[model samples]
Target chain A: MGGGKRRRKLNAERSGRIAALPSAAPAEEPQAVTVADAAPDAPKPVPRSPYEGLPARAFWRSGVTEQHPLRVADLYRKKFALSPSHQIATAGSCFAQHIARRLKGAGYSIVDREPAPLGFDAADAQLYGYGLYSARYGNIYTARQLLQLAREAFREFEPAVPVWRKGERFFDALRPSVEPEGLASAEEVTAHRAAHLKHVRGMLKQADVIIFTFGLTETWEHRASGTVYPTAPGTIAGRYDPAVFAFRNLTHSEVLADFLAFRKRVREVNPTVKFLLTVSPVPLTATASGEHVLPATIYSKSVLRGVAGELYHRFDDVDYFPSYEMVAGHPSRGFFYEPNMRAVANAGVDVVMRAFFEAHGIEAAPRAAAEPRPKGDREGGGRRKGGGKRSKDDVVCEEMLLEAFAK
Target chain B: MRLCFIGNSHIVMVKSAWDEFAKSHADLEGEFFAASGSKMNGLELRGRSLVSDNPSVVDQLKATSGGRTSIDVDRYDGFVLVGLNLGLVNVLRVGQDHRTVATVGKAPFGHLCSDGAFDLAVKRQFDAASSRRIAEMIRSVDQKVPIAAVPTPHASRGITGRSNQFWADAELLSARAEQPWREQLEDFIRACGVAFVEQREETLDGRYFTERRFSVGSVRLRGMTERVEEEFRHMNADYGALVLQDVMPHFGSAA
Candidate 1:
């Protein structure tokens, strides 16, 4: 008990000494405390030094300073302007789909990388959307899986059995099809698959800029084969072998290596292809990690962020976009994602796109007030007349006007 | 404070509200868990596998608490669990359908009926039951945390044609209606021991629907450009603002 008491006293004394170190120098030099305090209640007989005013300025500076600025809008505009001439390839998370969609809508040349038949009826397309690519129909969850897919596709390894009918053909199956009135013939399906693969390779060879969204570092893999399935095999259609299947939490180094390999492969296909990478801001709805859900989100996001940082530092062509930071790390609570999980706020997208444009000196087109909504009508209402209401538009506009006037 | 959430989209709205409200008040910190298309019976952990195939959520929880075993139950001041009709009704459907049909191995689960539509309905119910079971399991793991169950939303305007049937019979089935779901979800949550914040009826102030154009992802989901100036309009007047106001006062304050 005496020893414990002594230890506590020592700790208190040490803490006091640590705290007194900064003040001691000022005390000896007769520093101004009132100005130093800077509080509204502090004495105001004398004006603070110019350097003293810097704390508030420094605080504001800290808030806005960026380690790197990869303008997303500039990239979008450059990609869009070059779209007519260059075939743009997009792969990665759902956000990648957005880039592709925007490019396609703007009448640019976009390679069809998705396996599903595009351009089907809205209802039928929604159903097919659930089954495209792999089960979960989404891209591989980890960078390792993405690299593996690119490698496998490049190698053209024949499977034990063809996953689909070899000679099937489907209209626009290789591209986004708007109509889904009927099922494609077996021959059409096969033809479309082959055409799709060829198109993907061609796009990789010709792409001026490849936009990839690295989603999560957590993945489930086949232990024996190292095959990374998009979803757990059973969740979609593939067979799950417990003996060969294991979950992996990809490390920063592993993710960096995969990106390096992935970049090399892209260059091998098209040496001029620049890579733009972004982390998806969407949080996982659930996790199998048997831990509290919130912490799992942080763990996955942090690892991905680390990987992005490492890759950005190592390669000059590789740039990072702040989509994840813009939404998930926005000054305000993110109001982008829909309640039903179907759509993200268009306004949020607009903000990031605007930032991208401003940095690149590209004139941004006015966002359509009646921007289309997603399936399930998650946004509640349809559209607004005149202009839709946004909580921050006025503040943003005011700030912009002030900056312009100051300039 | 320890808080739990129930229902689907309605619960999500509440979460969004709380998220925004909490940002302004530094004194309060809280967490919310909401499952889309989830039901009450799905919360149960016993007699079934509750382990999610998606490891993100569990991994998040583990990381937040430092480790799996170190989940600080005492730090939570309250718990809220939202329960809607979908979970309960679906659990009942699973039992009823399991005995009535013998589709052999044709159906993956024994509870599904032979007809396609009926089978889809059954599948929907089972999904809800599973969600409830999961919720219950979460509660079981942390008994000290309070739980709240919310009901599904009711049909309002905007839903037309065959889709209207889903919302008409709220007691029988929890349709995809946002309003009814919010109301029932709030009631159930209160019953489950957490303080309730109601929003459905209050959310619909004075807005009405009209045709308009709207986009999703890169695809245009609704493009009625010729007929209407706006793609869609609020069916209620004040829109969802009232619910936000009602819940704002309770935020960061004691239950």
Candidate 2:
């Protein structure tokens, strides 16, 4: 609670600080009137550039390439430190799953409220989206989706499109992937979703560290309620209705606004909660902007990175990890992506996670991910590493839905 | 016919029932070879001789049966392994999945889905039961002796005082669909070379929970930290009486 209150105070004070106005360039002085006595009132000192006397990370030239082959591990000057006992809950994209798994493996308390009951194995639990996050809300990709989910989980918002029917079985439109097989009836879906929301509510209140990895900027919104769906309607379970649903690629400002509002809501419920934000490094599977896919990926990632920066700057409880910069940066030389290019290679994910631990002062030796193959084979989706599980997280991108009808 | 009942804290309920019933039925005799909680896990099978090292459990059994340390396998005609886990935590953990979350107070409940996955999960918990150690210890002593396992009973349906904590986490019992779980468990216990004693139909609220009248409070438990409050997991004499009624015919006929 102190952390959140202090964050609000610091943020208020930051805004209240006089604008760091740039010092005006000196005009040629009149030689005769140069005496300090000329002006009746003394001139105020111009603020020095905020960059003055800052660390290498504050400057692009020294912080990035000059350090050559960038070390983004220390990229996170963490605003809040996580103790081993802190209950961490995460939800975002597939990359967010990696963060939860990494934190869990590192002996952090990942509060899984709705864990798959006893006899379920790890893989099946993940398939049904149970063990993947704190709750069964699956990979939340967009800022709007994250916002909508928090609202729904807290009972603050209820979407118009609650259930999507397919012949007989009904799916909770918000998290269609959560139940691998659709639920039996709309009533069953509603009951299960309520239980899920109760779990989410408890988890949000209990969590000390809320880790969210920003993935895609694009989202499909239900026109009537503005409900953000993780994937397009027809992509996963529900049928697409062009008249009812619309596509949105959120701008940096919109993303930042959504997160700020989200931060406000969470602090209302859990003022002590700290946030760890990261921009996903994996490239977009496809984009609807009609631009070249490469540039579209850049635009999406850029918007997310900008929001991450703003949130990190504005909130005392928020810190951004450069997982995006770590893998996608030129330093790694595209060595971390699989042959598919869209899927990030496990070696790349390993480097990203190692830096996460390194930043948080956690020991990296506990990693069973050590002792690996050549770390830099760009064409190495072959003989998939990290066994089948890691590959599952990689190859399955909900955005791949855009390519379902590719020429 | 003479019989021996060995278990953990859960058997306290069954033993109370059996002892009470035996008083009325002069033809039957029973002995308790069970321990409480962790003590049961430590049971040793030294050369086909099942034994407990807990002094308290041993002292109580000695007082009950006139100081017999090891089961003279030749003496008792049949053995019923009770709580030693065949009756406790694991059963309830698996069984919890089968109960519906009840909203109404004192209302009946049941599991809607009785598919293979649910049944398989329950059966697996049974197979992996820690109580199986006690059963195996007995079997090692005498290969042909009949051993019946009573899964720790689900808690009473009328846990009214702590309903908030109880309903939030606990699962309630259900009827028709509960049979597949029962059948699968029977098959599993049968495969383990032990007779499966099905719970009685008399006291059950509706297959998922038993009536409050059959519930036993924590005062009956051993080795538990003294609690000001009572635990509703163990059952009463009426419920325990039904256990002997369920298994007595088989033990009586065979012995």
Candidate 3:
């Protein structure tokens, strides 16, 4: 709380100083009547370039070009440190699952309102989308989706079609993957969603820190109700009808406004909650926009990254974690990606988490013991040399189905 | 009807009780195939026989089943799988950190989980039990023979004075919460094509603890000697007789 207020004051002072400076460049002609003419006896200020005295991290040559990707230090600095006791709630794209998993493994007080019950297979629980977030709302790819979820959870708004029927089973349109097999009937879906929302509401009201990873800008929404779905209707469940469901690529202002609204709604019940935002580094599986996939991904990521930067500068409580830059920035030279060049490698996640933990002054929990390796592969342990087979693409990305339609 | 009782150490009670039942009913015949705790897990379906490669399990099979190291399962009219860790205690352990709608008011410290999720979790736990695995193995070899699973009995009521942290943690459980776990277990076993023979209702003190008389003087599997008074999980011959009574009806004319 104090951090945001302090940063705002510093920013105001900096702006005032900038405003007091000379607005235009001086003429090349020799000025006989200089500062010396007005104050002949006064001391003259020394000439210096605007970039003088800036830290090494400010320059590309020293910050990235000359340094090893893994050794590029000071990539992240916490605006406010997280206490061991803080109740941290996490939600976002599939990439955010890495953050939630790491936070949980590191012994942070990660708030899990709707945890998978005991004795369930850990892998099956993950498949069912439990323990993947603070609540089992599946992926919150767009800010609009996040805002819609908060509204729905708090009973302020209801989606036009809450249940999507696929064959004989019904799925909660908001989070189709959370119940992978779907429910027996629409009534069952409604009951599950009601139970889920109660926990989501509690998670939002009580959390001290909420970390969100902005994933995608392209979303499918109900034309009438403006309800943004996590994935396209037909991707997970429900038939994709052009008239009923409209595809929209969100602009910068819309993403910012959606997050702002989400923050405001949560703060209404929890005034002290802080937000940690990041941009998911994994590229979009397929873009609905007419542009090429590469350019579309850049546009989506750029919008999210810009929003995070603006939010960081505007609010002290809204810190930005550069997981995006750590994994996908030029310094890494695409080294952290798998062979497919989309899913992040295990090593990439390690580098991001190392920086995150170091910034918070916390020691990261050691990784779980690796299984016994084959004779020739014992050297690298977890991640092999280069982005080899060990870069497990384990995340559940429903958007990947769009790629199946490519051919 | 000739019956084959397959299980771990918990089968001792049922085996001794079956001997008593056979005296009055000359038409009924039964044989027990047992091993130490979890050694029954080593029993594999080899062709038409259920056999074990582990020498200790092989020795146990011989000692318990009248020198027969392998069972020709088709010879038996029905099979009862006894205690391979499917029971109320394991279900109660899950309540340490999660409560369903049935348990929310009773459990003050756990997260409130949905009843459906909690039931699925309980079903998975029961499904994972070695008893269910053995039942499935039997059914795979013989699809038509009647098969039933008898879960381990509830702890003795004498546990009230104990300082075991596990039992203390289970204090959050009530009969209402336990009902779902029971129903889930039965449903899961039935789904696996095995009948679930529940613990005798009269033998239970509460829903999850057996009456002390049924648990007292329980015998060990290695010998027919009585277990020490501190034993809380093993059931005595009287308790086993009730279990047999529950299992018989599932085999139709066997009752």
Candidate with the greatest lDDT versus the true structure: 3
Q: Which candidate is the best by DockQ?
A: 3
**Candidate with better lDDT, 1 vs 3:** 3
Ordered from best to worst DockQ, the candidate numbers read 3, 2, 1
Instruction: Output the lDDT of residue A24, model 3.
Output: 32
CAPRI quality band, candidate 3: acceptable
lDDT of each: 0.44, 0.66, 0.76
Q: Global lDDT for candidate 2?
A: 0.66
What's the residue-level lDDT of A299 in candidate 2? 93
lDDT of 2 by residue, A1-407 (tens): 69999898778757853233333322122122333634657684332543444565665555565664535524666677888999999978767777787777788899888766556555435545667777778777777778887898888899878888777777888887565457777887787778778888888889898999888888788898788877678755788889999988899988988888888888899999999998877777666678887998899989999899888888789988888888888777887877766567677777888777887898753434421221111111112222243223334444544565354
Query: What are the per-residue Cα lDDT tens digits for candidate 1 across A209-272?
Result: 7777776666667676565644443332234457867777778788888888888987987887
Candidate 2: the clashing residue pairs are B7-B84, B8-B83, B8-B84, B87-B151, B87-B152, B110-B174, B173-B208
Candidate 2, residues B1-255, lDDT tens digits: the string is 788877666766666666567777787787776556646566577765666687776765565445677666667888877755453234445434343333222433322222333444555555555567676667666778887777777667555346544343344323322554566556656655887776667666654666666774433556433422356667665666677777766675521
| Deviation from native of the Cα of residue B66 in model 3, angstroms | 22
Give the distance in Å from residue B24's predicted Cα in candidate 2 to where it truly belongs. 15
* Candidate 3 chain B minimal-lDDT segment of 10 residues: B101-110
Tens-place lDDT per residue, model 3, A1-407, is 59999899779868775444443322222223345445766776443434443566766666677678896876688998898799999888755677777777788989888777777755556655677789888778889999999998899999988889889888999988666667777876887788889999999998999999998899999999898887688866799999999999999999999999999999999999999999989887777898988999999999999999999999988999999999888778899988878877778888888889888888986654531111110001122222123212344456445654455
Docking tier of model 1: it is: incorrect
